[model samples]
Target chain A: MTIRILTEGELRSCVDIDREAMETVASGFRGLGEGRAVLPPILRLDVEDANGEMDVKTAYVPGLDSFALKVSTGFFDNHKLGLPSLSGMMTLISAHTGRVEAVLLDNGYLTDVRTALAGAIAADTLARRDAKVAGIFGTGLQARLQLRALALVRPIERALIWGRDPEKAAACAQEMAASLGIPVEACAEGSAVCAEADILVTTTPARSPILQAEWLRPGQHVTAMGSDAEGKNEVDPQALARAERLVVDRVSQCARLGELHYALEAGLVEETQAVELGDILVGKAEGRCSDEEITFCDLTGTGVQDTAIALFAHCRAQARGLGAAIEA
Target chain B: MTIRILTEGELRSCVDIDREAMETVASGFRGLGEGRAVLPPILRLDVEDANGEMDVKTAYVPGLDSFALKVSTGFFDNHKLGLPSLSGMMTLISAHTGRVEAVLLDNGYLTDVRTALAGAIAADTLARRDAKVAGIFGTGLQARLQLRALALVRPIERALIWGRDPEKAAACAQEMAASLGIPVEACAEGSAVCAEADILVTTTPARSPILQAEWLRPGQHVTAMGSDAEGKNEVDPQALARAERLVVDRVSQCARLGELHYALEAGLVEETQAVELGDILVGKAEGRCSDEEITFCDLTGTGVQDTAIALFAHCRAQARGLGAAIEA
Candidate 1:
């Protein structure tokens, strides 16, 4: 058996924020929600002494020929050593023989792409058809990708970016405007952007809430994808309580560790009110019943998405002959 | 960053059952037992439809320069398709930058070696110094490996082999006798072998207890390395209850999933009675205070062992220039 190796640059050249990838991620969620996928709870290790942590996420979706096991690490203090904070690779294994078939050393670029695609999936399923103005918080890699992803699902032509560091936010707007072919503005205040946004995305790792309930509008849709780990909250608990429809990427995870943990802890929202994003795609639950309905999605990321994107990347890499295969 | 790829053949040539590798595994356990290692709980995914399962194991020993994430899969029904029952690989990553360092496509060879070394560690610590007659149950790879490992710790001169298949037992005895330079006897009954043996090792996947408490003799040290998952037992619960000293690879794990679970479930053993194997290695606890004491150790396997073995293989491969490093 031989294993394919795709480098970060190779994966970036083959994988992009596109419609097919978004649909593939959507189907992955549907597989989980429809009871055809086996997703184990994430295994996380915290190396507090080194100010680092690692998470292993995996899932087996029956119809897929392969499954992926992704090991992602976050060394928060790596920046001091001139290293990236996030680094990871995915190992794709054949379902039949359980042998590894490919290793994607994307350094977390594929993770960012799949995560952004999941945001597109949520928006395509819940956001209003004519949603044009997007308000994005946190001007990081995810912030840039999410805006581009939102454009694929909604008619988002302009975006207002906000960050704790105003200079970074302004730089993000200028780069996104040039790359995405849209007018991007930097907002001095987060609330100012939230007030005019047809769709809102909160992508900050904050101990306290960054987006409040009062900033929400009737036709606005919100995608909160930042508060994945415990004790991290991006959207206020009251925002979920006041939303007409509250959805989560995975109910099993969000209820315990994601943003919903705080919402459930504060007794602002009942667990039953949070429908799964997969259920909406699989026609098991209603999504965006009316354009006036305020829809919110809490995405903590899921194993199924990793498997979907990894398999997709492998297929694309093989077709383009973009990776090297070493026979073992 | 690039990852070094070591095939199964390459890793096999580089890694072996030796004093240095065994010592490395011992230090890993010591790190865990001394609270200097971050070992995460195993993440297991069960694919009932495909009759397959996968486990993700990893650990961080602060003293080690790198950590490993091992993805092992067990597809029992794969034999029908002419494939092995278990397949796996270990990915070694940098502890400082969390970058990919090497991938050992060992095909479960390293896992078996580390597991066998753990058996040796248990025997070296808890077994009597004069243990010369080893009684082994099972005719699989682990049975052969454990016997070789036992020779490293004790002055074994002979082995009594017992198996469900008598033909396999006879074959095992013949092969072991020729290779190990020891007299090996094939016993028709398990009781017969257990009666005269100084050291006993159970390496089968039997669901129910195979080694009876009545067969255990004084001064005998038994290592149960089979029962890793819930509801799997190799030694009878009564045997553990009757032992003078009981040690577990990991108390938190063995208490819930290892052979100790059955002993605890039978209400014959207290959780506190099961000391960690590393505790004895680190001199924090006594191991076999008397030659007459019957000691038992449960080896469910842990992430620390995987990390240690992976690092050992990576370093050996690098020194020998046995692997190919592809720049990412």
Candidate 2:
């Protein structure tokens, strides 16, 4: 039997700022919403070694005929040893023949990109079209990707950055301002940024609500990108109560792993209240109703995204002759 | 993050075929029957590009901390491309953080071994105490592995081989006899050797029943190793009726993908009539009620086996310093 092997360098060279990935994922989401494909299943592995903590997850999406299985080890304790906190690889297998088509040593780079792209697509559908200002909380890699992806979908002329680390937030603002060709300022307080921005993006790994409910303005849109796992929250529960519209990637997954978990637990939102993002993408449901209505999109990330990104990466690599081929 | 990369050669050196892999997997079956660990989930990939074929598979057991997601791709048309009909890779990921630890390019060798080990373990429990004669069907790699694994668990004095191709069967008998230090003869008729054998193993890829109900004798133990997917059957459905006891790896999976599928579909047996192989291994169910009763152990293979074998391989490789370490 012969199998095709695509290495990490090849995969890296093949992937870029993948608009194709975003579009493909969006289409996959639409398919999921339309009940055209099966999302294989989610498998979780909890790792407890001498190295702090981490969780490995594999999500199967059948339509792509591929599975994007990610293994990310959290060695937060490794930082004291001068090592990175997380490291992992994503393996893309041919859904048809079960041959591993690609091995990506991305160090979570592709995951970050896909996640950010989802946020961008969500913002494109849920955010007010004429919104001008964007407020981004958290100056992490996710925060950067979210900002860049938001800019791709919205005409954000200015961005307000806030983080626990003021120096890091200032640096993040400067970098975003220079790279995006937009005005960006470091905020002294989270409430100030929340009040000024028309679109608010929360990217922090906070266990409690960081944004206040009273600060939210009508007609504004919010993208909650963090709080994916259990026991994680970043938005005020009241924020969900105030929103006129709520969108999620997967209703069940969002209710369990996304921001909806807390809202549902607190009885702030009912099970039938939230709509899937794909519903909005395919026009099965309303996204933004009026300029004065507040909207929120919660993303927990799905296997469909992984499958889409992998397919896009494979095609892009093949077209550019980016990957090395190995005989099986 | 650093990931370990083990090539075929390195993996081979790291694994202890006799004691580590086979024995550990056997023990895993026992553990599974006792409900000690969770086996990885089974995933199917349907190949539409090449031809209409599906790879049905399950990840193995004993991989609580590190799971080797087993994927097998069936390309029945690969012969036209000068390739084998099946190809796939086993991806091992850290259980702690979900970082992919290694990819073993075994080309289904590991799968064959683990499956054969299951058969061997079954034979250890159900076969006659003084078994002397062995009959094997099929001249494929699985046939070879089954014979080898049987030798590890039994003291066979003579062997008989039968296949669709007389020449292949004769060659298989000759090679196995020389290597195993046992007398082996190629039988002209399929059931000629079955009448006198103490243990019979069927390893064919036949889509219809190849073994008849009358071919078996009293005190004979049958290990049906083929019939792993839907629409594939190697033993006669009536043969299951003859067995006093029928054991399977997993009742649910076996009913769907093993010889039990045919029997159940034919209304020859029901879920209540079949027993799991793990049950026998853990002594929860009886293997052979009496020496004179015919017994059949259907081997459908499970994800628990994959996890067990992969974990054993990884540990062995680490101990022997077999795999190369790559930067993540």
Candidate 3:
């Protein structure tokens, strides 16, 4: 057997967050909800002394030719050494033979794009069709990617960016506006940003709630994407309780490391009450009941997403001969 | 960063179950027991419809320069397709930067060697010093590797072989005797094999107990290398309970997927009663207390072994200029 290795540049040149990719991710979520996917709980290791953490995730979807094993590592103190904190590689294996097929050394670039595609899918399925403003919390790669992703689903013409560093927020807003041809503004007041936007995306790794219930408005859809670990919070428990409908990428994951964990601890939302995004995609659950109802989705990321994206990238790379093939 | 892709042939040439490699694995176990290693619970995925199973394991030792993420896949019916039943690859990451260091596409070759090394380490620590006759219970790759490994620790001049198929057992015995320059006999009776052997290794993936307490003799050390899954067992619970000293590669793993799981469930042993092999290596636990005592070790394998072996293989390959290096 031979295994292909795709570098970051090659992956970027072949794959993008577009309609087809979004549809693939949406199908992954559907597969999970429909019980056609084997996704195990993520394996996480924390090296407190080194300020490092690593998570390994994988999934096998029936009828798919291959599966993916992703190992993502984060060294919180890497910024001090002028290196990015997040990096990882994904290994793809043949489902039929259980042989190594490809390895995507994208340096978490594909993870970012797949995650953004997930955000877009949530917006497409749950947000208001005529949503004009997308509010974002955080001024990082995800903040920019999420806005670009939302525009593909809703008619978002403007964006409001908020961050602890005002200068970073302003700079990100300017860059995004120039690139996406959307009017973007940096907001100092979080509540004001929430009040004006039809959709809000929380992208900060905050331990405490950053988006309070008092700041939420009706007819808004909030996609909280930052809380993928325990002790991480983006939206307040009260805000989640106030939502007319609460959606999650996966019920089991949300109960452990998502916004629903905090809401569950506060006795605000019952585990049975939360809807799964996959169920919504598969027509087993409702998404947004009405345009005037506040909706929240806790996305703790799933192994199926990694599998879908990795398979998609590998197929595309093979078609275009974008990676180097070596002996296995 | 660049990642060197090592093929199975290159890995086979560079790594073997020798004294140095066994020592490396032993030290890894010690690191885990000393709390100097970060090993998360293994992430396992099973596609029941396809008879496919995959496990993702990783560990970070504080002083190690690199860590390893090993993805092992098993497709039980692959022999029907004229293919090996198992295939996998290990990705080595630089601990300080979390960047890709090398990819060992050993295709489970390294896993087999490391597992054998673990068995050898158990025998070296728990078996009697003058153990001469080594007993093995299978005719597979692991069965051969384990006997070869045991010869390194003790003066195993003879091996008693037992298998359901006498022809296969006879063939294996002949091959091992010719290669290792030892007297190997294939015995038709299980109890007779156990009675004549000083060190016994169980290497079959049997669902029920193959070794009974009634057959065990004093000064005998049994290494149960099978029973890595929920329903697989190599020895009877009664046999384990009767052992004077019980040891395991990892306590948590033994409680869930090893022979100790059955023993604990049968009330034959407690989780606290079994000692960790690493603790013994680190001088925290006792190995074989006396020559007249029967001892048993459940070898379920661990991520620390993967890390240690992968790192060792990568370094050796680099020094010898093996494998292909490409941009990642």
Question: Which model scores highest in DockQ?
Answer: 3
RMSD of 3: 1.2
What candidate 3 gets wrong by more than 4 Å, as runs, is none
Better of 1 and 2 by DockQ: 1
Provide the lowest-lDDT 10-residue window in model 3 chain A: A45-54
Tens-place lDDT per residue, model 1, B1-328, is: 6679899999989899988999999999999878888988999988776688888899999978899999889988998988898989999988887888998888899999999999999999988998999999999999999999999988899999999999999999999999899999999999999988999999999998889999999999999998889978888899999999999999999998899999999999999999998888888888999999999999999999999999999999999999888887
Tens-place lDDT digits, model 2, residues B1-328: 4455555566656663474577778777876788765554455434455563434343424335676666566777767767677765677766544556776766676776788888788888889888878889888887877888788777888898999899999999999999889899999888897877899999998998778888989999999988887887999999998899988888887898889988998999887999888888777888887889998989888877887888788777788776556555
TM-score of the second chain of model 1 compared to its true counterpart: 0.99
lDDT against the true structure, per candidate, is 0.92, 0.77, 0.91
Question: Compared with the real two-chain complex, what DockQ does model 2 have?
Answer: 0.24
Candidate rank order under DockQ: 3, 1, 2
Model 1 stretches astray by more than 4 angstroms: none
Cα lDDT tens digits, model 1, A1-328, are 8788889999999899999888889889999879798899999988776788898899989889999999889999999999899999999988877888998988888899999999999989999999999999999999999999999988888999999999999999999999989999999998999888999998889889889899888989999999889989988899999899999998889997788999999999999999999998899999988989999999999999999999999999999998888776
- Which is better, 1 or 3, measured by lDDT? 1
Candidate with best lDDT? 1
TM-score for the A chain of candidate 3: 0.98
Clashes of each: 0, 19, 0
Question: What is the iRMSD in Å for candidate 1?
Answer: 1.1
Ranking by lDDT: 1, 3, 2
Q: State the displacement of the C-alpha of residue B197, model 1, in Å, after optimal TM-score superposition.
A: 1.0
